[model samples]
Target: MSGLSIPIHPITHNPTEAWEQIKPTQRVIKLNVKTPTTPQNENMLRFVCMSDTHCLTSHLQFEIPDGDVFVHAGDFTRCGSAIEIEEFNSWIGSLPHKHKVVIAGNHELSFDPKFTCGPAARQQHKNAHTGGGLINEIPDLGIERAKLKAAVEAENTVNLITNATYLQDEPLTICGIKLYGTPWQPEFCNWAFNLPRGKQCLDKWDAIPAETDVLITHTPPVGHGDLCCTGVRAGCVELLSTVQSRVKPKYHVFGHIHEGYGVTSDGKIIFINASTCNINYVPVNPPIVFDVPIPPGFSK
Candidate 1:
């Protein structure tokens, strides 16, 4: 079926209900990555996915399984401070994965131009009077406010992550699989990379390449892994429309709503919400792993 034919309206509020509604029509595969698994074909590439570490990689209690590719959906830092980025980079460098892909989350304010020097920054500046300064506007997150200010003002804050490929509306090919990463999501608490719902969000999704094999975003698509404990759906409706109808990637990986961590599918596309941290800000969730057959002419 074509993506355009899929019905995305009357957005489902409960993820379970949404899954049930499509269960019969779609083939869903829920894997337990925490347990030992049999070896797969050498021609396939294993992907280990995690997100929302929130600068707490050191607190992780479980061992990250080995994989050929490591994909971090987003939210690796608490406040996107320089120290946090450096620590994350250092930690990722220690991983055994041959290819690591990362994208900024809403918390990575320093990596987002719209939040640092655009209208959002101006708004923060205007509100600084109540809090003292831009640095003061942000709550104390262990990092000093003065240092955060410097990090935010620094050019090319994305460069701080040298260990992994940081993607922001860009594409990178790994083992012949074309993967595209985007960070924009619906406006949430005036966070970074936020755009108003509807056209603004749709425009960002439209930028995704149709030939993309793997799609990564900071936010989940509607009715997938986007249900919040508050009984609200936080995923992007426009993103779902774009994914189902246009991109149609083999895998759609994301993590923003910490509670919505799992794997779901629409029969056509596999949706994985690899949220490493739970709703309580604890790093208890395990990394999700999946394998994709190496495309023709591609060697791992």
Candidate 2:
């Protein structure tokens, strides 16, 4: 399925089988969407956030839960491949939510992320060194993480998803609340969507607006819900700084770290890491649900 592509129906009243086929065995969370006729009377709009589903279509049978909008941070597919994307899109479209926001993670390499034409893959290592891509040297023992990450993504083993096909990256208003999303993850040993620290990842974080009412990110900020297998926080320090300083959205939802499938808050901002899969890729974390107040400035 190198160039796999599947068509997806928009969010609608699709049959249960539509989602069942994609997901074979998994717990499902049934969510209820607000009625269109209902007024934005509630001070807060209900929001449900989930991520790292890894193509767990079986989970869909449980119902997506109720909320003003449905948000997917990233890693919606196992390999992020075209086939996986279509599977995800089709299932997502079946949901009857007012709006849906999504973004691509390093694993969700929707397009040809491999830098077959980039300088890194073709970079030369003289001094008795043979041909090696740009990932040859890094803190993770110079394992050429970038090239490996790309290879795995392109392989579509988990199905490649990417920034190109990502769900939503710009400021969006739903039920009178502002929302934004970013899919970049921290530097890992050659994983997809990994952004280097300092300016590399910070640049993308800078793109987020300060007044965003709801922020959807694929990965968590440093010290928030970002923990690795070693129990060390693998989140981007710069992202943590940027999000706290420059981008102070009311609610930030993400789910790259499955181990930390819980919610945290900064008194002002609500952080949710609804990882349906555990750190070991088990469907443990349930979908996170909460209601956000709607300021008078926003509209439906």
Candidate 3:
């Protein structure tokens, strides 16, 4: 599967037009800084974000900027193997951030129950009801089902991530900020934690806490930072709806489309596509850093 090619589809919504139509009334600051620096205010908490490393942490060209919190938005591994998970955990453990949060991406095949042990896995088997027909006609791309099951049975891959706080449709608090992380995205090349574009994807987005201050997802909300180099938008439409209409977090962090790396805002919420890797799989992008003012009552 080294040279695997996934089909790309053009996104129906035009992000530029969408942003222009609902222009933010208030001035939203865009934080696409080059160097990492301490927060100017004592009450501000700095966040260092990176995603889509894909087992290339060692090849990063720049030092990970120091901050109060570190957020990894997924795709830390190429295939989510046990060795890859262990190496990622070790690399994360070396980071100095006091609070680190992580979530799975499509590449974390072993972490997703649906792909490892549920319907997706069953699709690999021959369908007896259809007279020995195969459910998925795509050739097996070398990911052995037996190995995945064996790895899961040996030990849960989630437990291997002991260094950072892993979230899956879960929430965690750091310095009074409510952060929720989810891995689901619109189905892309039938990877892990993927669901259909409509209701299934919406169902996952619906579980995000309404009071979340920061939203971390593997897939970018459509139009924010989801454009691929091939001129297609790889973002989830329902996710964009959920974020703007309901969650409305102060910052939305994500990285899946490697080419879509940067920061954008819609007058209200800030969106960050912190993909450390470029489209060529090189760790050329710098980690995104931002400062969030701590709530008056909250102490660091």
TM-score of 1: 0.85
Look at candidate 1 and give me any clashing residue pairs: 3-245
Cα error, residue 128 of model 3, in Å, equals 15
Residue 135 of candidate 2: its Cα lDDT? 35
Instruction: Give the per-residue lDDT digits (tens) of candidate 1, residues 1-300.
Output: 133433344434343455455446545456434533867567998899999999899999899988888999999987687788899999999999999999989889788886478775677667655765555654555666666566676666788899999999999999899999999988776667877766677777877888999999999987778888987778776687788777889999999999989988776888999999999999998998888889999897
lDDT of each: 0.81, 0.60, 0.78
TM values, all candidates: 0.85, 0.69, 0.83
Model 1 residue 14 CA deviation (Å) reads 13
Give per-residue lDDT, candidate 3, residue 247: 78
lDDT of model number 1: 0.81
- Candidate 1 segments whose C-alpha is farther than 4 A from its true place: 1-36, 118-151
RMSD, every candidate, angstroms? 3.9, 14.3, 7.3
Q: Which residues of candidate 2, in runs, are more than 4 Å off?
A: 1-43, 59-62, 111-168, 297-299
Q: Estimate, for each residue in 269-293, the C-alpha lDDT of model 2 and write its tens digit.
A: 6667777888667665667877777
Candidate 2 least-lDDT 10 residues: 1-10
